[model samples]
Target: MIIDILAALFIVAGSFFMLVASLGVFRMPDLLTRMHATTKSGVLGAGLIMCGVMLFFVDSGVTLKALAVMAFTTLTSPIAAHAIGRAGYFIGVPLWDKTVKDELHGRYDEETHVLRSPEHMQDKQDQP
Candidate 1:
């Protein structure tokens, strides 16, 4: 009885987070904000679903697979979101104006001196 109750609660919580993620995907103003919502809510929702599945089906192989799925989601979702956000930034997608801190801006230029292509480097050498 207790397991059933716990499973129901987890399923409900997971569903709620999934709904929140969907709303955020539609409602967020920019790529970064949407990425944040996607990563956080996705991870949490998957975790809750896995927990509920484990509780509802104790000792089953399906539950083990769900656990693995949850683990993979936890590891990869944030990384995928970050990669997309970084790609968007590099491609010159403008961020929302309300964002206050842009710590990455201008920092990559200082860290790396090689901005142009090898062809440009060859041209520069040929000029001298």
Candidate 2:
């Protein structure tokens, strides 16, 4: 009885987070922010849903599959979101007007397509 209740709770919570993620994608002002919202909430939602599934199922095979899916979702979601956001930025997607800072402003080289860190820039200056 307790297990069933817990599973139901997890599913409800996961569904809520997934709904929030969907809303975020539509409501966020820019590509990066949208990706950020979806990546975090979507991964959590998927994990939670998988957890619920694992709990509800009595079979070892279902548990293993759920675990594998959860692992894959957790690992890939953020990486894929980051790559997509980076590509969007590289293609000159504009940030929201209210954005306060652009840390990547001078760090990325268009010609070489390389992003240099503050430490790397300091080292280059010291070398010369």
lDDT of each: 0.86, 0.93
**RMSD of each candidate?**
6.5, 1.6
Q: Distance from true position, residue 14, model 1, in Å?
A: 0.4
Misplaced by over 4 Å in model 2 are: 123-128
For candidate 2, lDDT tens digit of each residue in 4-109? 9999899999999999999999999999999999999999999899889988886899999999999999999999999999999888999999999998888889
Q: Put down candidate 1 lDDT per residue, 40-113, tens digits, no spaces.
A: 99789989988999999888797879989998999999999988998788777999999999856653343463
| Strongest candidate by TM-score | 2
